[model samples]
Target: MSAPLLAIEDLSVTVRTDEGHAQIIDRADLVLRPGSIHGVVGESGCGKSTLIKAVLGLLPRRSTIDRGRILFEGQNLLTLPRESMTREVRGRAIGFIPQDPFQALNPVFRVGDQMMELLRWHGLPGESPPSRGRIDRTTRARHRAHLISMLGAVQLADAEEALERYPHQFSGGQRQRLLIAAALACGPKVILADEPTTALDVTTQLQILKLLRDLAETFGLSMVFVTHDFGVVAQLCDTVTVMYAGQTVESGPVASVLGTALHPYARMLLACHPDRAADLAGIPGAVPSPLAPPSGCRFHPRCPEARDACAAARPATREPAAHHSVACVLHDEPATATATR
Candidate 1:
């Protein structure tokens, strides 16, 4: 396939909690192909957001990437200096759409002003200057035109008028669309959307999902979409990575991974989906704390298929199908040779 627009390999992140170092992410792996939507699905506290932040080099000061590489266009993001990440990567090469629209947009600023500031700082070469200069009419007009075009592209009604309004004036869905617009403003290669539709109503959620899918296709943008919903992944993602606790349990083409999930945790997660479960069952037991997770597989305590071997050591990744990998022992050896088949 196309060289990965972004590839996260064996990424591990930790945070300094009162209890000492808490492992927030454990060797998480993900790959985003050009012009495709890759979904990162997991329950809360599973390190979904932490993975995204690690990719963007936005990990908090207390957070540390203990190992692994975040390769974007062949460059390891973890090694890039803060200045390079700010000027060359984040916002310019990779854009972000946060979970909350109400909180993402500044309440005090007009939409136009906020967008103009983005353009002023991160806009394409020649459109933005290194140092602040006179806010000339030509610059203002160019920025306004681009904003209007992006707003229109996102289907925001009366784009011109909408730009003059404050964040409060727009409905939840409209605000989300505006965030999408801003994320696309700089024409980045990839967009990291951290459950952008989680706060919207059902109908609005569907609308946002469709918009995101369409935008990815239309702009040739690869997106890493983070969400807890399998239905959303089935609808909008070309590939999916399932994370449990702080580890990635399964990853592959959405059709392959979702249709015949090999990992016990992945299977249990699928069973918990509203459409798949007969009575809307929930996964047994709770997610283990990162500070003191289970000895081996993070999900071993909750996995119905767990065995003595599973709790002995973390499972190694095995591939039963092309482009599909699962970190579970059932897919291994003569003892369980047919388990995944």
Candidate 2:
């Protein structure tokens, strides 16, 4: 297997709220390989979004990376200088597709203007020193053509005329496609999408999903898609990591994780999927507050198979099958030993 393009090791993030410091992410780990799509799935408030933001250095003002490393390529993003991150990393090497396209775009600016500004800042993908100023008509024309081609790549109709319109002029799906265009405009190595399809209708959602998968393949771009839907993961991801109350509970190839989920929380999450459930169901109890999470396994309170040791200390991650790792005490014993017993 190829070395990871992006690896998040023991990342923990905290935020200062009215109550106190809340540890939103706790010792989370995830790995994304080159040219593959990895999904991060969990219930709302499980710190999925926080994990993504930490990678891009987009965390809120009060948030801090308490410890851990976000390794991209070979450097630790957490230690990168702010100027370098802004000029060399964000939008240049790593693109971002925000959740709400409506909110992501400026209501007051033309769609073309917004995208042009990005090109101006980052300079088109490969141009040395970046085309900061439009030296002549030719340079301006080049940027315009590139933007139009990008819009076209995302399948936005009337790409030329669409550039003249504002964000409000496009449909929900179209706005999403526009965001995708902007993310790909800089020719990034990796794209980070934070539930980009959550706001669209079912049909539109499916279309966006297909578009994302197609775009990734066409560009050979690696992606980290954050979503709560198992259906989306099964459809779009090559690999997946299950997060709960901040910690990663299970991770592996999507087929292995979905077919034989070792962690109890993972199984329960899969059970709640509409196709898998006989009736609509939800995991019992609510996610614990980050201010004072359960002592050991964050999911212990709701995990059916949880035992005394589960609350005593966090379970050490282990793999019973190749490429599959789970952080639950249930998998502490080797499969062969358990079977023999």
Candidate models: Cα lDDT each: 0.88, 0.92
Please give each candidate's TM-score: 0.96, 0.96
Candidate 1 per-residue C-alpha lDDT over 200-256 given as tens digits, one digit per residue, 9 for 90 to 100: 999999999988888888888899999999999999999999999989999999999
Candidate 1: count of backbone clashes, pairs at least 3 residues apart or interchain: 0
RMSD of 1: 2.4
Per lDDT, the best of the predicted structures is: 2
lDDT of candidate 2 vs native? 0.92
For model 2, residues 1-341, the per-residue Cα lDDT tens digits are 99999999999999999999999999999999999999999999999999989999989999988889999998999999998898889998999999998899999999998998777777777874354444456766778899999999999999999999999999999999999999999889999999999999999999999999999999999999999999999999999999999999999999999999999989999999989889887789999999999988899898776677788788899988999999988878654123221
RMSD of each: 2.4, 2.6
